[model samples]
Target chain A: MQQENSVSKLKYFPVTAFSVVMGLSGLAILLYRAYHLGWLPLWAYLAAAFTALVVFAMFVFIYGLKAIWYFEEVKKEYNHKVKVNFFSAISISFLLVSVAFYGYLPFVSAGLWYAGVIAHLLLTFHTVVFWIRSEFEVHDINPAWFIPVVGNLIIPVVGVDLAPTWVNIYFFITGMFFWITLFAIVLYRLVFHKQLAEKFIPTMFIFIAPPAVIFISYFRMFLNVDVFSMSMLSLALFFLGLLVFLVKDFFRIRFYLSWWAYTFPVSALGIAMMIAYQATGFSVFKYIAVFVLVLTAAIVAAVMAFTVKNVVLGKICVMED
Target chain B: MKNVTVVVVYIFGLITGILATGFLINISAETVLLKEMASPYDFEKTVEVLAKRINSTKNWHVTAVIDQAAEVKGHGEGDIGKLKIVQYCSGKYAYEVLADDNRKKISVMMPKTFSVYEKNDGRVYIAVMNGSFVGKIFKGETYEILEKVSLEVEALLNFINFKFSLF
Candidate 1:
């Protein structure tokens, strides 16, 4: 049984520890120089850094709490090393920040939004090699575990906004696959390999956050690309849901009516598209047709699932126990 | 022993002790001087377009001033009249956000900044933010309209990169 205080206590570390540290470290150098030398508008840099740092600090505290909770869940003896990964991740950020602030402009800061690009490319390469030969074998990797860690790595990548496709695809595919595969693995493990089914909560952002971005990106809002890239994002999230529901190992309470949370944001977008297609007056029949289109799509997906072997199930079935 | 470890990992948590966010926001300034604006963004058009996109936002101002405008001393034609800084925020939302919690310093990044400028010999540069970054600060119960607002900002920035050749 899960303890109440324990579970409640273990929140926030992953979000805070690495993200804030690196983000500030990378960006703070600029603020520090501006203030000491009085080069750029000090107020804005200070404000962004201060705000980001405070938020980062709280998130770090929360991440630590979660680490403690994880220790509590594992029922393991612990100390500061509980957040060893987090510290290292933050350490890297510190290193990058220090390097960045010392006036090492690789190209251009582009915009702060692109800051993740640098970190993304670096981690993308690192993670790709790491994934191709991940030492963490024998057990299924946790999406929550990897997202923060890899994200910690890529978090710094945004230092500049753009990178060649080859750079990002490596990280993008690896990151997405890890989570996507994690979702698949969870399903089969729940069905047949029960022992491997640990407390699995797919990181909230793994699907909802990123793919929503994929859709937002579809407007060609930030990066201009073809429809297929955006469409794949929608497909990725859908598969994520398929993986979530297919798994018996999930935090069912969170799922109770959450398919709606998963569906509404995206589907309404489609409905809006339909409205645009019709233009002007409302048609009840059109609304019905739109409803049917969504329902049919969901059904098609479910049908496809039956034909596909569960990734975890396939793995377990082949394992020699 | 195993269960005990779980309890401990469950106890202290990973990021508990550090004050991860605000430290940097309030930090003393330094310049890495990394930003190389290939081309300056047309802030006037950007502000006009963006103001209409955001709901309840008021007194929006965007500028493309010399590096001296930011009060920064230039090194090699450093701020040589190349960069643009865009500052924007919503009026009522700012008030509502501040009133919510003292620690919601994330919200204080309101009237946020988006800088656009040109690198020497001209490469037009334009950029804004990712939704996830802003989503953290918005903190509404429902991501419904908030998600759209985030998307709109991204879209506006993308438009600059696309139609205006900012990117």
Candidate 2:
């Protein structure tokens, strides 16, 4: 009976936690830079904290590697169209590390960039191949698909100066086109197909990522202000405004690794705001940057704390529906 | 046959005109923004030379040297050639700038960063951000300090380039 009860209590950790670990770690590194720039003196501690989370993320990645026995469930989740896109969050985390450390620790950042670039490309290419080779119901389409696509947009962030201009342009164009294609499909699904599953609802915030990420990418790659960059910023702000009302339901959901779905998009928005401030020298953008930095930092920290608590209480890393 | 020959000449002329225009625009833009140096030394040697100069200077120290190529390899992949960022800061200048409440915000742009990279053609280049142009964004003492720092930083890079060029 004791052994049976132990087995019963074991909850299977979802692969989605890969994203949570990455998202929070990425956010922490962003905050460290923000604090450093703002002269807040919290940069050092945050850097240490981020490193710790990176170590933990490595372990989680290993666990995911061994979870191949769960292939049946993985395939089911993968074919679901929306759910599989969350896998891209793991890619985002590595890319985030690359950007954060690009200045302070070049070698580490470069390594992470290479890792992020290869992983994101494979993930994205395979996803596209899947889309071409398989058929999915129209209703299954949602914003989560944007996750895999955003990886391309993210390359230009650090890769702008590091990679050749042509390579960066390739990623920028790929990301831009796919973002448009998915935006149309996702909008149609929202209006006509069906409401998204409750667990996947928070991913609505993902719509905010492409514009924000692309804006940052364009500015970094070209190192100049242009019409396209301005448009990206404008669209990003508009979508972010729309998400304000949409995310009301997100806060009501219970804590799950899916909560990490909210982290990177917000962090990207914050980074975009900073880039805008850098370009325009506007005080308003500066204030907005600080606001986003604090808000995402709080969200990531709270989620991380809760995650640890759940793990200790045997709520994570076991089997559950 | 006569008409086809004329059309081909016109097409070639149009392409030549476009290329000439592009070349002129690139030259003008280069003059307007950025003070760059071409290094005969490889990317790593170029960074090492500059880092040594900064270290030897008074009131300035090399805080960090970021080897971007090594970083990519650390992630279980091959290196990305030679891209690096060398960060340096003057303690005296930083203290002077941050001592005031008004100028504290510019601290975010601190540590005076410059990038060294080898492009696809295998030519090495060092690019420095114009601190003075950035300083123009601010007003008062902070702006003055940024302007001063910008010139000093520019001079440092040029000095490094000159010193390396000699060797």
Candidate 3:
């Protein structure tokens, strides 16, 4: 009876599986960024991008059909904010891949990039309008709503030089404002409302992302360091410190693909520090950048290896058996 | 009397803030474009001569000569005049920049590109990204190397301009 129960518990096509893109692409860009910063050799960027592409391809092939199933499953629960926003992970993954390859293949990268842009526009519009149109409880709010918003900020990293100036500004303004609005809502939920569901606790790490990403995007947009850039960096550091204090709480949650949620925000902060070091030439920031890079890289590597092992063992995709 | 003084101070502060911001914006807007002179030579001859001159330069190797005009024409767009980007990289500088973490970011702007294009007026122009100003934003060994590279870039453009002047 216990064996049957275990088999029944398997999640062959969890929507959360798309989140592997977050780690794989995040690390790829991290390596590429490292290559740009001279932390890694030239071949390192190529190798990292190749690895991300392979993993992305495998994900598409392995979960392609099941993804449809996952979509249907989630669509049934579409009223849930978490399920609805999880769809944004797919779009965000495409954005990350586009950024990883952008330096190498501009034309092809642009194609994937615009796909992400359109996806974010459509998904965010639908999700936000649904929120405003519906009569929802305050407890429904969570950091995952920030996922859809984060994509706008991330667009400028790839789009600033590649796209038209107006387009770049559009994404920056949209992302910046939404982030502020969502930050207030998510913060209010955290303080006034009850503790989030266990699955959601890992996503608290996402709070680190807005400032981290804004730092990068703002630097790129202005090509100069100023009060705004410094403020973003400070906020990112503050969030990083906060996450560290909650490290024990992070470990208490059951491991799921949602754990991938923790990778990109820290990765963004790592890349942000590198940008700050470049802009200010501060050694301390460089050290912090390297430290964050190493820690995030290691975390991503461990999580990915464990995930692959679990997948192979039929412990993940297979029904509870 | 106190309220009147406070109102005057607030007005003065707002005007000063606006003027300062306007001054900053004006300074930021002053970007130097890398455009060189109009060549009497047509697109084909200019690109050919430019490619030869570039390859002749020490440590500079032309990696690719992209025929962007052919590409746009391939898209069924009616003929736009010849536009080509000649990509070249200095193996020496590549090593220098790639040697350290801070310098690696330079690769984003790497494989130095020169766009050679002709206008509707039949004038051919050569231009590059403003390297010097971009380099100044970073500090460290990367900044030193980038500054050096920017100077080298300026020298190359001047040399090309001088060559065209002789024609």
Candidate 4:
């Protein structure tokens, strides 16, 4: 029996299959363009870019089918096989670029690098459409038609020299919105859902890892992550509230661990923002505000760490088991 | 042991992602290195040249320096973006990219900087390449000066720093 939220699996049979094929082809051309690019030619880059956008359309289809977001077929392909393939594809692409970069093939390597950027953007879009809770979520309105809506974005940027630049910045902003919103919803689910923070908290260390990597990556790109960090800080605020709400239930050791899970990402972001504010220069109000927030976060994390010693690991956890 | 194994996998993924980013960043950083300029010019000077040449500042804010940006320290052998930020502007060029319709792509170029910076010793520097800008300008029938803008800017740098020796 399918869960109430799990919609039918076969809602997007044709659209999905077509999208997967186009996506595979686009990625194949992009990969070949990394080395091959003989018969395909310069226009092939445009073709791959176009095809990649076509792939983004299919995501709209998948999102349209909300409940059965993870059909057996979709799961089999994307969750396991495609994830490994794309991850390796990016990894190998990076390795090749590294070799060529040191060897001084900067021109060719730069082109491939930008193309890889495009691929990564596609992956980010896919993750948002499939995983996040938003208007684009599969279940709500079913915007499979929105595929072409997004594809329309490529018409302006494609075949132009500025295509990559224009498309990349555009996608970066949109992707940030999606990722931020998703992060918020996940936090919401954790707070209200109760059991979620428990299960995910055990893996909270994993939660801290990816966003840290993403923040670091965005930083390296010369992106002013003040906005992203601000969003992260907002999440930290909610986590703090949740921690405070649960403080009265001092006996629940596992719930307390959940608070720490939230703190990890929140504190990481608060620290990032503090560093940013320092870089921005000294506005007393801004500095005081950032200082207070960071100091509060530090206090929270310090308390959480101490709890592991004072209560959870030391006493509470010891008592529970 | 299972917990340790999981943590190990998590750490492994983090390292891999970072390595991937570093590898890709190298290509963009290096591209700025090899692509040479035809003359010695600073982006500010280029802005001046462009203003004089084009006779229009109405749509272009040429040679704008980006201030208060954090220096991208410890990047690598040739990471220039971390050092300096030089912004350029041309609404006409942006109009061209957007293809005279659907202004959404306009945000891509966003009247941003080409970003050039000189080291304290003035030996090393970094900047961005406008492959499309050049490609667009030169490809057309006019042997347009805009075609060689980034190259000229590089040349301008060579002049100022006496490194590439555009003179």
Every candidate's lDDT: 0.38, 0.70, 0.73, 0.38
Task: Compose the digit string of candidate 1's lDDT tens values, residues A1-321.
Answer: 346534443531232235334433423443432332233444544464555456445655655455444545322211122222233344344333433322222222222223344444454455445445645543444333443333432322332234333544554455455545555654554455434323234233234433433332332222433354335444644754665575564435332111212222233233223322222223652454355345533632442242233322332112111
lDDT of 3 by residue, A113-190 (tens): 666887887877877887788787889888988888898889888666545568778988888899999899889989
- Global Cα lDDT for candidate 3: 0.73
The reply for model 3, stretches above 4 Å from the true place, is: A1-12, A61-64, A67-71, A77-79, A313-315, A318-321, B1-127, B130-167
Residue-wise C-alpha lDDT for candidate 3, range B33-109, written one tens digit per residue? 24245554678887887788768878778999999889999998878778999998889889988888766767888
Q: Which stretches of candidate 2 lie over 4 Å from their true place?
A: A1-11, A42-45, A48-56, A64-80, A318-321, B1-126, B129-167
Candidate 1 chain B: worst 10 consecutive residues by lDDT?
B28-37
Error of 2 at A134 (Å): 2.3
Model 4 lDDT per residue over A1-321, tens place: 544222333432322223232223323333222222122333434453344344444544454343244355444435432132232233223222322231123344344444545554565455445433333322221212222222222221221222334544564355345445545555565455545323233223223323432343343233334566445445544444554566544434444333333332333333334333333433642554355444533545464465446543333321111
Q: Which candidate achieves the best DockQ against the true structure?
A: 1
Q: For residues B60-151, what per-residue lDDT tens digits would candidate 1 score against the true structure?
A: 33323223334554333344544556566645445554665653675645565566555565564644444333453433332223334443
DockQ of 4: 0.03
* lDDT computed for candidate 1: 0.38
- DockQ by candidate, in order: 0.06, 0.03, 0.02, 0.03
TM-scores of all models? 0.34, 0.64, 0.66, 0.30
How much is the lDDT of residue A62 in candidate 4? 52
Supply candidate 2's per-residue lDDT for B35: 42
lDDT (Cα, tens digit) per residue for candidate 4, span B1-167: 25576578768956876676566555444333333232245444543453353333345555555432343434333444323455666666555555535445445645545544444554333445544233332222222223334333433332223223212
RMSD of candidate 1 to the truth, in angstroms, is: 14.9
